[model samples]
Target: MKRFLVAPLVVALAAVTLAVLPGSPAAAALIDARVGALTFRPDAPGTGARRLASASVRQDLYLDRVSGTFVLDAEPVAGTTSYLRVTFGHLDAGRSCQGDLELRTDTTSPSNGFTRSGRTLRLVATERRFGYQDWDCAFAVLDLDTNGDASDGSVRSVLIGELTDVPARPVLAVTGVQLLDARALRLVRGVWTTIEVTVANRGRADAARVVLRGSGRGVQVRPTPVGVVRDDDDTTVQVRVRLTGKRATTLRLTASGGGATASRSVRVARAKAPARPRPGTYRSADGDTTFSVSGGKIRGFRVRTTTRCGGYPDIPTTTYNTYSFRTVGVPRNGIVVAKEKGRLYTARLQLRIAGGKVTQGRFSYAGPAACFAVERFTASRRR
Candidate 1:
């Protein structure tokens, strides 16, 4: 919020680029608009009529799920403004005059008009007739056909229409993902996260009708389905990717939409290493070892793994606790259980072979409990 109480030393209306708007069909495409925030024009200084010193314009578009409407957001780039005429949509009722986009704007001025420049200047409407800038001319464009144009006229700020020729998309980018196990990528069981897919208009021409698809074998969509809320939106879908079957080894995801295609992979398994060996539990980042026999002594050992990486910058990184074993062999057979505050966290089994290096795992937790796996696994082997 830019406050201009004590007249700004100078009053200047930062430049404004009134170009095309969002939710528009295929066309030459309008260059985004620029908001000149906190403009101070000394000559036309702050007053009851013109008091905007400078300001910025931020334009964003989104597809509304409830209203099935396209929403555009215009924010000041630098500072506050006295008035802003956002061009989002215009309709020519009965073709009486140049169609004017009915937009909702929070402005500083009560009197103003929407204008445009072309072969012949046209006046959409004066602010006097329509006190509120927002107009709902739903029936106006009912018969208007936008073969290659999505607007009623050359855009000054906003425009909207239907797409006649579906566009050709070139690239599908995986900007972000949620509910995926960090290391294996298999869907983390019982969790929901957001996944983002950014589809760039790659071809020489613009494309429309963009969609994103994700699926896998037995890899059920995790009871969480994903879809496109809007093309340029940062948050796309909330997905719950889960790998429930221990027998199933893999989960595959594919995204297709906007004339482009992409794929991602996730491997599922017991979320951690083995969990027993009471005083002899230990684990490594990666690699599955059969057994560790030190000096012909079969030291019973179980390895485990976990994660807690998602945290604020101020949060401390999770630390790995190690558990030392007595001898190089498997401890007594027992259900390797890990508990936190009386809550059953994970369970694993310890199995060692005679005259051979064989180790069987019991359990491994994947979240905060994962950090203490080794220390707990080693504690189970206390004689």
Candidate 2:
């Protein structure tokens, strides 16, 4: 098995186009929040609070996962301070929130209050509550929905001072993808292969509903769903893929969840061709039964029976007989049917051939009382 380490590549969050909502104050106009790099807000959204310092908002956001940390550096305001209110003007319909807003605060001077509505999240750091200013806060949007959907986007990050969207440090990363059988065996063309993907949760909080999917040219891979990855731990999931091409190809894999997404790509060599089975003589363990194969056809077959026939136990005086027959070309499934007839009896033979050998055969005889009723046997090629 060959494993490919996947560097955590930050997938850009889906771009959202925003138009200024009617009647909103000029300073608080709805704006597009494209967070991959650091975005600075120089002016506060409204009257009460000051804009956050440069690169103060760091956000890690996904379709259904979101989290971030913020430094709300501002002068003390006397009245009800509108510290931060996130306007999620980008979310689509049918998108609802789950998981309580987990906001960890570092300062006690100004008590914080969080509220969520249809598409807006408001964080209030009011002086009237605790008489504090200039604090640090971190939060994560635990679950976007009970079931994750790429069509929905949630709170990227909640900045306590200005209206900005950001994400937390990346959490779940696809550290490696292993071609389960690549090391010991070359992948055979048109054959299904199993691959294992490793995912690690590198953040403080647990990552939920992580799913991994793979893709490649002329190849097929099944998607794997990983429920959760606890903080600082890792897990592996197995997926089956089929290579259909003869030339080399690259397999791309992606792991996404918990407001984070990571991807990796691996190059796979051309698949090997199948080998044909050799033709030879095969015999049963007792040497009483034998089959001859040549040019993929059963050339000769024989079985000598000395046991019970139609419930007649073996005895010194029991009649013994040998039946022999020649068969035509073998079927694709390796089944052969032949018949032998005598003046007073008829014999039918059924044999299965596989892996250069004959196996699981049955012989049926119908005639006088001394005839053998049925016989079962197996045979392998002599090396």
- Candidate with maximal lDDT: 2
- All-Cα superposition RMSD per candidate: 19.0, 20.4
Over 1-383, each residue of candidate 1 has an lDDT whose tens digit, in order, gives 11111122111111222233577766534222111121212232223222222222222111110011211223222233323322322223321112244332223221223222211111233333333233221101111122313233311222222111122234445554432113434333332222323333323333334444556554455433334424334334435344444555565555555455556665544333233333322332243222354443445443434434445455645655322223322323221112223253433333332222233333334334333342112222212
Q: Residues 159-184, candidate 2, lDDT per residue (tens digit)?
A: 22222433234377777765421332
Best by TM-score: 2
Which residue pairs in candidate 2 have backbone atoms (N, alpha carbon, C) closer than 3 angstroms, thus clashing?
59-166, 59-167, 60-167, 60-168, 65-259, 67-167, 67-168, 68-168, 109-132
Residue runs of model 1 more than 4 Å from their true location after superposition: 1-170, 175-183, 186-213, 222-236, 272-383
- Residue 11 C-alpha lDDT in model 2: 14
Query: How do all models score by TM-score?
Result: 0.23, 0.33
